[model samples]
Target chain A: MAAPVRNHVWVGTETGILKGINLVKKQAANYTDVSSVTRDQEVNAMCWGDPQESEILMGCKDGTVKVYSAEKSKFTEFHDCRGGEGVFRGLGVVDNAIITCVESGLLKVWQEGASDSLELQVGAGVQKMRHCDAHRQKVGTGGKENDLKIWDLQKPEEPIFRAKNLRNDWLDLRVPVWIRDLDFIPDSDKIVTCTSYHQIRVYDPSSPQRRPVLEAMYGEDPLTALSITPDGRSVVVGNSHGNIAVIDLRKGSVLCTLKGCAGSPRSIQCHKSMPLVASCGLDRFLRVHHLNDKELLHKVYLKSRLNSLLLTSRDKWEEEERVAPVDQDVKDEEDEVWDGMETVEEKTATKRQAVTREPDADGVVKVPSSKKQKKKKKVA
Target chain B: MPHIIYSAWGSTCPAARPPGSVNNSCKYSDAPAEGHGAPGPSLEQDVLLPPTFSVSEIKNKQRHHYMFLKLKQDRRREKLALKKKRKKERVALGDKAPPKPVPKTIENQREHDETTETDEFAPYFNKQTTPKILITTSDRPRGRTVKFTEQLSSIIPNSQVYYRRGLALKKIIPQCIARDFTDLIVLNEDRKVPNGLILSHLPDGPTAHFKMSNVRLRKEMKRKGKDPTEHQPEVILNNFTTRLGHSIGRMFASLVPHEPQFTGRQVATFHNQWDYIFFRFHRYLFKSEKRVGIQELGPRFTLKLRSLQKGTFDSKYGEYEWVHKRHEMDTSRRKFHL
Candidate 1:
């Protein structure tokens, strides 16, 4: 298996910059998009291109799918998947095909060696297309005023599951539909969705009830992003107001709020094994929050407004600490050498002034013995 | 004789003087050749002495004074009788003291008192009508600071962001207020990390300064593996850690958007160095048992602050509007800014 990817949060920014943030090291490494020499393209969406999670499939605003290789530390391939109407909303890699979904709801599957891509219509106004790694063949699609539908890639005909709107409100008013973000619960047929109306709803397709099995509300601002906690019993959701809260699915109540995020949070992802959730947003900040106690672990400023981020499982900084002793000694020696150079410059300047002053003394300056004797007599 | 006496009294009373005689005399005087002798009193004399009475020259002064006293006594008696009658009527009606003239200020004070009394009991009632806020961090904030700023913004209703690195709190306060921002939060950073925060409420302000330490995020905490289904119990926030903290918390709580949009599923969260104040709200839900239940969800966290200061922000002493006051009070009068 490809060496387990190092533990880092990969972030895509609006300015087409990709950043790998080392949480343990508390540092961010930036990579510029070299595809266009003229102007930078907006990185709209990104997904792991291969099962090894070494290649990042980047969906650009300009209808291009560029695969950035983490091993090579550069973009390896570029494919043009022309969006007919709106910009790309989602991007993913299913086996050898690059799956891309645009805002206009055109889902295209591009084969690795093929010039032309296979197309499928996912209805109109698709906001997000989510691929479930647990069930590799399933992808979820939803948007504003659109029903949340899950589709099987193997059979592109009908949706495996589609969420039904809850019964009419008390006054018989039709509830408006606005699905912001959703995630499929691992090992279950349940899907948890956070809405723009500040709601968290969990729908179980296995059950006969069309309405959500559990629904809870978080903050006063519409929830823009959400991620299932490592335990899968809770979900961490962020709103347009930049508030992040962990809501318990069973009780439908907020467990705690993880504070210290400003600006609207765009995306949130919880690590599968660690009690950590990484979030990024318009504030251009990548924040890692501990799940159980709601404490912020590490914060990296990426400089540009971050739209989405992915976190790896392994910790790279932990390995660096094991090999830091020799590197520290070398760095210390270099530091001393740099310090010695500053002292050398000062010593040379003093000598040059002494040499100039000696010329003014003329013939008397040639008698160094008499000059030193005179100076000693004056001191006495 | 009665009619003659009445006419004599009318002529003597200057206020009751007939207009015809004055006009006739004026007309005759204008034709001086024909009417040099046609006046009872010359117009010139009338002009000089004006026929108006001085207080001392009035013949009915004593009588007028006596009549005034009599009328005053009668009015007093009538008023007393009316008051007694009203009192009797009120007693018959089983009413309390008569209504007094309540000034607008007193009315406002009483109205405020009633609302506050209600708020003391049911703080969750109608919480949506709070002011919208705008939260920003001090210039060149680190990632953690921006995240904190966003967290603050999310906890308040209708709040938006104005992100300019290293923005002066004084400059942004007025601009945010002009934009209808009810509150302005400025996260102050030291050595590129947030260590202080200033919550300046817009328009009228009691800008709160809090020294932040042990700055921790959720990720920094060790997992306790607490019961997932234990539903974090409801906290009774009737009393706060400090009086000032209570007011600040109330002030922050009062900024939630009124008439919450159920479809949008909004939430408000407030967190400082110590405590986390959360306002989780779901719109109307209809069920059989409760019929209609509105869930106001949030869990409280501890918050700590150095001091609670009021008034506008200023560069000197790092406070505004209170510059003159601070200068008068401070003996050293040194300039300080954050």
Candidate 2:
């Protein structure tokens, strides 16, 4: 049960099972009871409940948002939100309230213990909705034929920034609008989106122009998921054909393509600080790639098709290894006792040797003995 | 002259030469060359000859062929003598002889895949629903493709064969679901030969697209049995052990009826070897308790999986569970996915 604290990634599978993967230990454990869950409860979207990331809000296909507390290693609560016709496209938490958006374009904010919740229709065919981490009241929604729109939760009457469709092509035919995934660029009002038409667009809400300021195309297949890098200089986007590439925001050129993805990637998320990105998809494997070296650091097969994944925001992974040994000490008292006895035996042996040689060389023995004591204290 | 003859004889019969003696001969040969007094003529001739000698180095065509034949015969004789000695030793030991070593194969040395759990085929094995398959060919399928599809429909019980007529698969899927079709099989033809097959399970799906080749219809197969009867044929799936393999095996299993009529004595086998699936139809007759005679029924072909999608046939939008990337997945000959 203590292993959940060290899990670096949480994956939601099509089989309705949530798995916590510990890359350091090379182990993955199912957090949900496999026997009790059905396919209808398949996890569609997942998000952190708070800035601390101690709780995970998982939106299931059956129109229920289940809150899982990482500290408790179990589900803390379940909220029913069944007004939409399709599965949830996004989930977010702001000020203890849960924000959920379904594919049918029904976006709702359920306040804590409230019977009547705030509901709004952003548009039909909502493919993705993302809540801005910097601005708690701001959320972005986009979908098939639905342009990118950022709405302020406080005033749900109208959208704050609505993206305009691109101009007609060379033949004067209208370009289709299908935004598969979007993310708000941290430290700014710019929203980066990847479309099913294999286009990546960056929208600036502060500017007067409603059209995207920058547009880039990666591959022939439709882009399914994208996550902005922590530095906000590049965005990692994966298409429906198992190809993942990092696109530079400034120049709109591909930086590098991450290899070893055999199926379409369903979800991709970059670490908050470290140059690491974790992605999982229909390939049934969660792969963590280093953003700089483009090296595959870890790959774990979760046995089922993964729908979404959430990577922990906690940095300093080496610090966790030091803390893990202390947790093990509480479980194995006999091993701790043996370790303590061995250290005491070594100390007494050194003291006896110093005493035996003290008479022959008093000043020299004292110098080495004092140094040994300091070294022993540091070891303890 | 004697040293030159000895070195040449040593090169001809490698087994006669003692270990580490090639260096010794080279050392001995170098001493005479440095001295250059008694055997000057022989030394000059030896220098012209190669240090290492083989039959292929012979200059005359007739002599080269004769020497090569003799060398091969010597090697074969030595191998046979060694085998005979081992057989004699084994016979002397009798019951105490060690067990024979198992031969290594690519399949035996294959890398173990982690995801080998097999619970996805529960519905098919449990016999919850009977198979109702709809078989169709590509638009304006040629004579050979039409014949292959017709034979495929006859092998599976309760299946209907329909003309494609340029109808879109996306549109036909919903109509098939409404009519309670459990599975849909589409044969794609190029140049009048069936080259592709798409098998999509109805309602909710796990569609599999395969590259099909080597089609042999009933008329083409020699000594073929009569056309397959309407009785349900038993399905036999071989070597489908991995997780992805199990899913494919289940897809094939769900295409036929649950129970087989023993009276028909027919069998449809999907045999997998090196990731290539060979489909065969056969009719058997039990002559006695010890003997059974089998006859081949028509329309045999091979299939190699291209991709397995999670949902129905939406190539542009569907998520693929496993896709065969030639450069990535096919790195090792010993590693197999199915």
Candidate 3:
């Protein structure tokens, strides 16, 4: 009965600490330590690796990264990614490897279970460098340098399968570029790659040169976050604005636009079996949304803004609950205690500050926040 | 709506490694480790569209939290009511409390003086060799298969399989020994049975999994006061497996221990990218002290197996990658590490 539960959302914050939102009881728990701390700079980008223990690996702003253990009620720093300059804003997780977007337009891949004794090994950057979505053979992710490059652990420098074609599209003829936010469709042969200026092009992994089986242009808005459904039927993209847009993958059209998020959603993630969509942004709210119904599932706002999110399943949470003091929800009841006071005014004012930094940069119109921020409102 | 929130406070399912179990990747994992030598470097970037992320891909996860919240509230409310009742009794009786609700009330309501419902002389005798015990035992599956037939055929002493069928009353065992068996199921369903075998109609995969060896079903005569074969369905017994450890359930009956398990053909069709799992299990005996484990069968052992044609039940079929998905009762037990 020691398995990890899918009950809470893990949050990577600016302070290099791992924060969590218990979906069950609605509470905020923090894991903070700096022994093998990844980054000391403002935690820029983060993506939670699959739950190894109670910890999730995170890429940071300081050209560094690290693994933070959520198992420790107190944050226990696990690893310090010393491999390369940390991720600028993007992170891709496969099995134990953390593929992050480094500043040099290069991808840094790191493995979990690495004996992170030193900070070098902890947030050790780019152990095996490779391309994203090489595993997802469906969609094409344009190429690097003049051709698509995939690094195989088989041969770290070279790709298992590189460019299937050597043709240029309209944009390539205009301005050549590198790929960002690349993902493969689950159980399919589709691959998705997002680039600067909100341009997302898809290619069949089997045939890289063929026209994208699906393509969507987000105009000038850069895709802030990207995630695929477990079934790979849909996709969600978040931008500078506090909005998340859902799109149908098969048809490649906008399904719905949700505007309730209070801050710029940095990263959005969906857990395996449990229906949970986690998003974190400058707003400091770790919000969990139900994917099936597109409803707010849970929110745990912390003192610092959230940059990345991860989670284990329900059963793992149950094990921790026994060791916990009380129900996490009971803690949420504190919301009522501060009603009708100066604290409320100060909170609203802080949100106003957050709103300035988070405007709708993507094509999605920001949804009204009056009712959308309910889960987050009760928290902070 | 009944919502179950995965509580941060709840416990995980009982887990065990079954000796050499490999922690499987999520079913939907792209780089499925299904016995892949190891993950290849994914840094090869051929630009394409990443799958679109949608809100529906993550909706209604609130049930997990609510489940935990409601459970705790229920427990808290119950505790308060118990305290209130104790206080009320203490105040009224001056420290001497009355007994609580009647114990085993269901037992008192179970008696019936009805006479034996059916006659033994009828073709479908309704009374047993002993007095009508009304014992409750679990039912064997109505779906019979080749494995069941083979097992049943073997369970019976081959020489004495049809003592009653041949009308040899002298060989009848007079006693109905209940100790050797955990449950006795007698199914008389309208199944597409073979010419003479009762288990002939069952699905091959599971019937083999059920360990029906040394079992037999035959038509017998009603003694002067015994023989309870009836035409009606009744649950004579129940012995549902309990969770002792992780996967204890599947070691005996679980064919998909952690397999999105690909048949070699499926693997080849998917170019071995579909992932593969070799199905294997250890058989079980009711009283065996050592639990049947999966490790001995071989963990992560890939059988370059191919897929069988659809709906083809060649009982002695060999298309499956692994035949050892099942174990026989006579399998020699060996020592292994957990």
Candidate 4:
């Protein structure tokens, strides 16, 4: 007998259970549970990975990020962003941290499981971060300030590198122009960030002072989401008007627009395994498309906007949301792995502002701020 | 306690790190508002907000139901429309002007045999003296293994006496390949075999071997048997010419009975159960290609015996049945609903 093809289609809907579709035989007779996500909470984003790892993760409208072990039909309560599962519209898996693009204008990250003894490694509140320009070796943090600060674990508080905002080269910093979506070119050192007012700027982070390599006009609407082929040849953008356009990066031209797709697409992901693309829209439609052939694979109707999705596969990554305060009382133990790690240096340095108060009865540390305040008052 | 947790991820690369967290420095933690207490006031303030928006939710529910109903209706309409279109195409095929409706040729339509109108079997000669002989092909023509032909022929001698009902392609293609094949071998004879069901498998070869095994509801016709009037089996085999170009699955051969006593039911049952073993052909059409065929009933054969095994499930058993197996033969076109 010939070998049967190994492929299955997993779909998430707003109501009922998730469905598994077998395309080879044109069969639509299988169903899985997304309710393990949240009872009546609209599934916002879904990412597929290995099935055995039960690594399928779903973000629901209830403000909860639920990581499900679909193989064993189990789920771990990952995080609650808003309240239940807040209005999550964007989801991306970069490097095991799940990157969520929410309506809060704040980017949040999550990881797999509980850390060793609840020693706080990192906190949330991820800001303007992009892996742009000649590919990102490190993450860039953007604030209301005029400079783009790039951070490395070796030095956490201060940026290892910074870029001045040419548009606002003044004494004071300007509020950022609301960056909406970013796409990293596969196997290259380039990233594209689509901002409000229909502007997609291609930047090479390695060259901080330079202008964008290629700037494309997206017309007059804000993009809700974007995706890039792993080869970095084509870019697909989904806009707020429920419009989806595929752009050939090499030619920098719009290849084509999908029709009969009615809704404002909030987020979209291009599947690497096949010529398929998935997008979520305000029309409550999660449409899977065949990118190369421009055929609609399937449209899963949801009750709310789809934010992110990961397909099925093997070892899974879950966003580590919360950890207890690190026990500062532990005696210096050489075997403690965190003592030798780079993040330890970075995390402690970021917490240095409070280090000024925590001396632990050792004169080795001194807080100078209180003395400075006393001298200023005496002068006044 | 020594902990050995087997962590698995849904990725092809088992050892690779998770996506999105390049630095793996995801800070920020949110835990359930630890009971009410805070700035002296607890974090449970969100609980005081109206539990879910009833009005907005009601409106959304109505809209969702509307769309669901609409989609269901659209699917139903699509299926009905496709079925109707297919039915129309099949029906149109039978009405096309057929080539040389043998019974309605200009000459045959003009000629009149008033004297033969008395007996249904009376036409050319006296039926009383000539005991009608039925011809049955021995399931082999040419190119067949001699042993096969002999084994089959030995089972019923006088092989040429049986009526055959198939076309030979390899021998007939050179004479007619471009012409639209329309002529069929029809025996308008009052043979000992019932006229209601005339079956044959002519021009036999090993490759042309087919087994007729199923039973069907056979229609029977009658004629006045007492008349000693002029009547005989009209031999339709004129020059024994093949009209079609080539055969893919349906071969060109004739089938009949060795003896003349075969009834209408027997002939129809054999015709219904007929099977020609061959390889199945798979065809696909390009989007840009123009198709000339309007309606088609293509039956492909298969030599892969494994394909003949029973399906993963049996409908009657209502569950998995792994033991009993069956061959996947053609002719079961309607056995499983599309």
lDDT of 4: 0.39
Task: Rate residue A339 of model 1 by lDDT.
Answer: 53
lDDT of 1 by residue, A140-174 (tens): 88888887888888788888888899889999999
- Positional deviation of A317 in candidate 4, in angstroms? 24
- lDDT at residue B84 of model 1 (Cα atoms): 92
Candidate 1 residue-wise lDDT, B11-96, digit = tens: 33433333454432343233443333555767665554323332334357675465445446655876787789988877877756
List per-model TM-scores for chain B: 0.42, 0.64, 0.16, 0.16
Q: Can you write out model 4's per-residue Cα lDDT over A1-380, one digit (the tens) per residue?
A: 01121124454555424444333333443234432333356665666433232356566666766665543444544665552122555444444655554543344454455332111112123223443324323444432222334444334445555443436437666535545666667666566666554656666666654456666756455665678864578788865545577877766678876643454565677755345576765455557676766767566554433334444221000101111125332322433543544554454333333433432322221212244345434544
Real A-B contacts recovered, model 2: 0.61
* Candidate 2 chain B worst ten-residue window by lDDT: B112-121
Question: Which candidate tops TM-score?
Answer: 2
lDDT rank, highest first?
Answer: 2, 1, 3, 4
User: Where is model 3 more than 4 Å wrong at Cα?
Assistant: A1-7, A33-39, A44-53, A72-80, A83-101, A105-149, A161-178, A208-211, A313-380, B1-338
Q: Per-chain TM-score of chain B, candidate 1?
A: 0.42
DockQ of each: 0.01, 0.24, 0.00, 0.01
TM-score to native of every candidate shown: 0.46, 0.75, 0.37, 0.35
Task: Report iRMS (Å) of candidate 4.
Answer: 28.2
Of the pair 3 and 4, which is ahead by TM-score?
A: 3
- Model 2, span B13-65: residue lDDT tens: 55844456564455544444444564555655666544566666778787767
Q: Report how closely model 2 matches the true complex, as a DockQ value.
A: 0.24
Ranking under TM-score, best-scoring first?
A: 2, 1, 3, 4
